[model samples]
Target: MADQQTLQKMRQLVDQLNEYNYHYYALDNPQVPDGEYDRLYDELTALEAATGTWLPDSPTRRVGTEPVSAFESHQHLAPLWSLDKVKTEEELINWETRLHRQLGDLANDSLEYMLEYKYDGLTINLTYENGLLVQAATRGNGETGEAILAQVKTIGAVPLSIPYQGTLEVQGEGVMRLSIFEAYNKTAQEPLKNPRNGAAGALRNLNPQVTASRRLDLFCYQVGYCSDREFESHEAMLAFLRENRFPVSPHLRKAAGIEAVAREIRQMEAGIPQLDVLVDGVVVKLNRYDLRQEAGFTMKFPRWAVAFKFEAMEVTTRLEDVVWQVGRTGKLTPAAELTPVEVGGVTVRRATLNNFDDIQRKGLQKDCLVWLRRSNDVIPEIMGVADEPDAACSPIEKPHHCPACGSEVVEKGAHLFCPNTLACKPQLVAGLAHYAGRDAMDIDGFSEKTAALLFDALDLRSIHQLYRLKLEALLPLEGFQQKKAENLMQAIEASKHRSLSRFLYALGIPNVGKRTAGDLADHYGSLERVMAATTEELVALPEIGAIVAESITTFFGEERVREAIDALLQSGVTPESAEESPPHEATAFTGKTVVVTGKLSTFTRQEIKETLAALGARVTDSVSVKTDILLYGEDAGSKLTKAQKLIESGKRSDLLLMDEAAFRRLLSE
Candidate 1:
């Protein structure tokens, strides 16, 4: 046993390391060096091994003792549900036949299946008292779990309080997208292995502050208990959860039978990356409550629902070489050059190493035999190296200097950055390309390839120079037609009159996304006012936090940025604020929240949202009691039913259903 003094030192070391780990892993920034962090981590591991009194809170416990080579044991509350697995149409037909055999004549009754994206994340149970969130527990050894209420609350999509003042038990999965995970990993300084790992880490975090930074989102798919209401079908249950202001999966659809379910699943699989969150498979559930009860639980899993997991996309490929690419922010990222290997029906020759740390962690070497797999059917990544070593292979090393500027690289958390920000050619080119993007200036002929050509051939170093290019200079360049060049020039000229919001968005200020840009534009009314505003003043605005405010201030404070803005202004590219029209007289829908769902024949979703925004109505993505009206269009799925129920219950007074002609007439009024 260690002495008192030794134990005190060990405790102090653990605390310090934990704090730093939280900062590095959770916050994406670290104050300490990698060597120093590793030393402290090693010390803790050695001490814990020697002492044999490992603390429960230790980071070492993150890697659980039981090798989860196969599925881990979980005792689900309602027998952790697993769907009947089916690969082909024949298997599906067999499943239907089995159901008929079990139910006998009951199977002949009209049966329906509710299909939903089997979200790729950790399963969690949320308990609420009087509509206010109380506790969130993970699906641990099934019966009990690590209470992570604090961490769960940090998720913006998870409501702290709901419209219904009733006791409820909500079951859902916390899903993270490939893009979100990539963004989070970029900031975290430690490369997250995959979306599942990222979600698990975010959910299990002890500090709410840590979880809040991760931007983890949730989708409630099931209701275990409800004091005030009961649902007859799985679809109805999901609808009820949404009505209570719960974040439910957006991709849920009610299918008539197995064929429809299969179709929906196929559609979801094809469009996985387009979704806001990650889904590994499709969950098909028996819609009727009676059928669900009849086809009840096994000891470990439910008999009703089955998880039709998508086939794993993995292929062995030869690592030809590694190449480092500089991003717009001057951060160096490594990409693997691989011998072409097909995975997930797509030809794959390249994969992201994520960062220098990832490269080292995987023990990747040149000519190494590596297994590549698409994480969530998107973003091909190197999973692991082969067991047999390649005698000719040499270990890959990160460049000590930036390839673009030849400047010494500086280690900033997980990323190695070139501090020669102004001198980097790639940074300037990328920034210019971003400025000319479709959502920004909307330049017609400015493709990324064209942008590179202009930067290299024309000596155009800044976005400001694009407007000054003479027709003669452009006409001489290879493949430059007179009409195309003139069109490009005209487009640049037209972009000058863009709205303040677009201008703000085009600046590419860190943390100032499209929505934030809109909010800033709305609040400030002009770009000049926003530029003149101090960090304190910016932060004082509603929804604008210190981080965003600081980024804005820092962006404007830069000499290069100021020069670019001034040059653009001088070049006749001016951002003008749209004149505010007189407020409309209070209509029945004024000061209300409304949700529009399903196929709209009169107006597009965008048009409806715009009309609502103009009429002083808050347009939300989902339905709830706060939702004053749910304007239902044709085939308006579960939301329409949910809205009807709320209206019937007298929880909401206004529920309006309109066909195409009626909705068009209402808009006109």
Candidate 2:
């Protein structure tokens, strides 16, 4: 048993250390030297080790450890409301106008508003009970979220305890400050694309240790739930948070009217680029709690608040050159090489130009300054010609010959394609890589670089030639050790018996992706049936259109393609028949159209798709108005965005958004 003196010492140390941490992390003001702080921390650690006892708000609990197997669903104490968005000042004014109209007689009363930066990061809800941090969760579908307690604990800015000593839930944005983001990217093997992604990816990462490494910061904005006390206004709640040392944003400003709020938003927009964190917009909220209640809410957004969203960041850069690259399908696409410029903190050197026609339509010329725009962490795109081109600047011309193989380029509709598929080196390499991808043949350790090496070293011109490779031939290639060569050979051998759907997808039929290939495999059940199907027969299927059917028929009719398929079969590539469906009870998902987005810890994309299919769901590659369900996971991107928009717009009223845990529950049912 520990003595009273030792326990008192431990308590004192914890309090002192926590104070130091609050100053350093939350307030950016260090109260003591690093050595002194470490000394106290070590003393506290030793005490805890000796006693086998820990305080509820002990500083030692801050270090992230023990990753959760899966995030359990957490029901929020209060519904986390999403703010309505406005792009223009007029729209912002209209939002206020609507709020006033909703309040009825209260419209005569001057409405006070609070304006703050709309942080561009993942939303987090932190819960505390009896002055100790109890839970942390994502915003998710609002009513419920993925519990991320372990991950949120890693953030130093989040207080472990509050003075109120009551059950409470506070809302915040988990952000990786620009300074930390820059420092991390300097040494990261795969540098983070942007700060927002860095924070989102880290928070959603399954491993708590990975989340700790990113050094995330949180800024508490609203008192989401409070059991013991009620604040009269938003300002009073913010004051209570500040009193408890919560990392609240210092930029929160009070505005008298809609016009004042608009002025504040303009000022905030001007300083957005200079801020330490990414702010996509400024949020304007009604300050009075009663006023907010009177204003009420729409189905998707709170009527009391509106986010004034900024436009996508655009910058001008010289279009140094336009390069045409051959894809896996032998289509030549134009990509612009620009003089590197920073757009929204990410350096942009390359931007998509779509095609030769896009360059002409945009009036782009070599050595011309062009407008580049990037938003929502998407790939930067050349928007238009920013300025007049130099007098001597050359107009981008359509190439008559393929850049890779010097074969004649053919124009089909709006795109250029190389007819010489066999001789084109780029096409062969890309096709080989695609054939060996995880979704295709499930070949491990196969990369585009390896494909290029094989194409150059082994004089390999076709996919079938890979099967003809010998150990002797592979051993002589650059970077090929005996173990690597053996592994590659084994992997190649194992790929022979892959599912017929995989084999069909690996064949790289134009316009036929993995989903289409799976559909074909499921419908035909045999390779011969698929190969022999007429365009009319193919198009009869609900998913298959005339164009897709024509493409499939045209591909199978090619003598060269038929010969290649035969060669692969002769080389011991015997694709397994499609799996027969077993007798099972009908599921709720039966006949439903489902879409999945983002990285899942429980299953790969193909695995999830297959699971959905087995449960009688029709899984699609994209979100649409017809999409019945969207199962989203960590770092969910544009599809999730689009699905949310559709839901908010009431265009897809039946569309349901669920997390992995919800999907698992449905599976058990």
Candidate 3:
């Protein structure tokens, strides 16, 4: 056994190492040289191994562990309520008045407020016990959160071991530096939208390695829970937190009154351009903790704090050029190529013009200044042209031919199509890429370049050719190694067992996106049924219209499409459907034409279908004369009336109309 003195020395070493990590990772200023930190780390690791012990807060754990299947649920030490928001100063005045009303005699004439930038990032709740980081969770539903301990520990700014020994729950945001986000985007095949998105996605990733690679940063905003730590005011708490090496924002300021807060808000808005990362608003929190307790909270937001959100980020940029690119389905899309400009801290270079018709309708011209904006939670796009076109400016004209292969083009609905699927390089390459994408077949090593390489060298024309790829052909490729080639082959083989919906979606069927494919699978119950479905049968289903039905039939009608599917199936691509057995009361609704309407407390529309399917009943979306049973829940509408009409006319002779209560009673049998 190790001596008590040795254990104490080990604890000291651990603390020292964590401090070094903070200096190196967070501050970017290392006090000790790399050799010194490494020597101490190695010593601690050897000592811990010799003693057959592991510390929870050891910096060694920063290297991370095996991937977790899922984030574990954790109850918060205190509820993390969202702040009430105010866009205008008048709303802030009203909020203050409300706060005064709540405090009554306890209200101070002048309340000091701590104001800071409202960061656009994921909220993290960090727990510390005995000066060591114990757990880290997301804000989640406020009362409970998912334990992201592994991913959170990877963040250098988040202290592994602190100076104080209090059980504290610190609330902060996980952020990514704007520079880092841009740098990552430059190398990333699939680029991130913004720093906030990168940070949030990194934190939730199942793999700790992926999180660590993201180089996530942090900012501690508030102290949610602190045992053995008390302060008279919010500013005092922030100061104490900063003293313990937490990177509290230097932008945070204490204002004496509403006027002072207003001045600080103006100053913050002016300083936004100079700051790093995205700051969408300013957060104003009452400095006095006692005042906060008296004022308390609403069901969702805090009464003491309010977020003053800035207007949406908008800018004007010149459309330098327009390029037409072909999609997997040969749809020629026009995209605006712009001189790099920043919108909401994201460097924007390119955005889709949607269609040729939109370009013509908007009179979008090259060399014209366009209003670029990020609104309604979408990527930054050109809202409209701001400046009139100059004599030198040229409007993007509808293309007569494909840009990639110079083949003849034609108008399809509002879009232009190449109709050169047989020989178009872009279409073939795009289709292959889509087939190997994450949401599709999920082939790991196959990229657009690799697909093109195979297409050019080996006459690989279709998706099925991917399954036939061998180790010999991949060995000669520039980056391929023995292991890489083998991994790619394995991944390609593994894709053959994907679900029916995945296969259907992977085929790149017209008018069939991911959700539509899922709906088709759920409704048809198998791949075979979907393939053989008539246009009338497809259009009769909920949400699937005539256009979608026509697209489906048209796609399947193609000889190439049918052959490709056949080839895939022949290559052992077995699309499986999930089938469940009926319960003891399976025969209750057997052979019945059932139609459900309104919202049900007991079951969802999907669950009703699944239950009926197991019982050998036909579940239709709409009420008809053929429907033998009409199950109405709360708020029955047009369908209910239609079903009643059919029943009264003796069209559905044995039609039984019932509510959710009656339906449940029947299930109980």
Candidate 4:
């Protein structure tokens, strides 16, 4: 039934598009005009649409399609922690003070800090082995991520193969260039919302061909895992990366301390108008890699680095109305409904007002003109009223009763609280949503409306009740079919087998995020062990401070929490024991940096690399300053000459040249 003519046409279009992309992006030389390219693209798109035929290299896939049912998880070699963020100089000073406290005598009066612009785009983990790109993943929950190698290889900035024949895992931000983003939006039938979203969406898009078409760029910053390479400092590492033809920031700088870093940040921000892409903030990092190791990390971020976030990008918009929202904890907060204004390229319809105090202080009213700011952050905040004396409308009043549950509202210092946490519509819905969120139970197709329906009709008040949902009960719902019902029940049943780390995170313990949950999982080893942990035991664990210990104990002590666990168990929901993925033995030269000097007679290039991939080895061809082991084989030449010169040099005094028999013995091991 396959159409040969259609397939041939698709291949021809793909080949033509590949050439166009090479000329435009790779060579910066376009053989075809924009109009002519667009016409050809349209024709190919039409042809592909008619037959529903798509090849991996097809250019039309750049537009992308619907999401997959679920994203397959890939465990990271190391956790991708976030950076500690500060919005004010005072906070930055406090962060520096903490760093000083940790460093003590090690603080070099004024240490050198590396400054670089922070991109507001998705973070990616790219791994290379034997010089070929093998794996690419998103920073999902830091430790576990979704593999997107097919899409990542399409990036113009990322090399499919590097010259270095060792294992390397690099971390970077995937971003869209402004000129390309704007041009795509102009021609797109349904335009992208923002630059960050466009960049993230294109990579996560299931169609690799589409991702290739987007022309996304990778800004590699950190080396997560590197073998057969050693650098004295972060700057040295950056230099090595640049030497390998990796895209690095030209604006990278070394500053003395907080003040110097701040000055650099100001310069970067001032020059933002001249740049094409967006930058949310500037990251300040300790220069020395050895110091970075000693500084270590907190539960969330690195102690060696801190991010200075910029103030929100401001724009004026009309305040349509104000609405009070109830959080999962029954806390009441206010948000302003705006007249749909585009702020910093993202459409802003609503902004947080913080609280009733903020609203009263600002004298905010309906139809009032407001100034909205969309900072380096995702959510925009309403700064204050822009119009003088505001628009002619009545001031917002505090509610006597909770809006969701009709319970009497309680007034706290400067906030409102609803006591009926379980019964309140918003709180209950929010709690259920959080419980089923992607990072938690990963329950697919469970929306707020569905939660509300389940709560009202079936009295689904607890997390355990979710597992008790039956197909017969689901059939009475507004939109229910035999196949859909079966799928929902199956998904619910599948969630019972999630790992202990995810289950712990799903419990919603205070101050415990995904990373913290992982720490608990690794320390305790199982859910049962975690439940049995005393406050003293918890506090003793690494990264588990006194406050976190108290929170964990307090959550477990709650009768409601116990009852929920019991019900879940009764419903046959049992989390799997925490298990880490198999570790990769990237190279055979363990504990020693290796430099392959000459030609080898025994093993072919590919065969030797394939063997090295099975062991812990760091193999490089460069005979430079930090090579620990130099292995010269039969018919060896230039690399041998370089190694001999480096051997005479005092910097590489500890370097050792071993016989091939040692490598053979390593192979036996």
User: Which number leads on lDDT?
Assistant: 2
lDDT of 4: 0.73
Q: Which TM-score value belongs to model 1?
A: 0.60
lDDT of 2 by residue, 1-669 (tens): 568888888889988887876554333334444335656877887888888887777766542122233566788899887666677889887877788789999865568988888887788999877665767888765777777876888799988667777889999999988888876643342346567667877887765656777899999899989998988899999999999889999788888987888888888777765678877788888888988888887655788888887875777889999898887778887878999998878888897656777788789999998877775455566667766777967889899999988999999888898988888998888888889988789788788899999888888888889888899999988899999999999999899899999999899887676668988998888899999999988986646777789999999999999999999999999888855768456887887888876657787655888999888888765576778999998767567898999999999877899999899987777
Q: What is the C-alpha lDDT of each candidate?
A: 0.72, 0.80, 0.78, 0.73
Which candidate gets the maximum TM-score versus the true structure?
A: 1
User: lDDT per residue, candidate 1, 565-632, as tens digits?
Assistant: 89999988888787887887786567676777666655555677898777777776556666777777
Model 2, stretches more than 4 Å misplaced?
A: 1-279, 282-289, 293-303, 308-312, 581-669
Candidate 4 ranges beyond 4 A from true positions? 1-315, 339-349, 357-367, 373-380, 390-394, 398-400, 409-416, 526-528, 579-669
457-522: candidate 3 lDDT, tens digit per residue = 888888888888888998987788999989999999999998788888888887576667887887
What's each prediction's TM-score?
A: 0.60, 0.51, 0.56, 0.45
Worst 10 residues of 1 by lDDT: 63-72
Per-residue lDDT of model 4, residues 379-455, tens digit only = 56565677765337656777778877789989877878898866787777767877787878888888767888888
TM-score of 4: 0.45
> Which structure is stronger by lDDT: 3 or 4?
3
Judging by lDDT, tell me the better candidate of 1 and 3: 3
The weakest ten consecutive residues by lDDT in model 2 span: 61-70
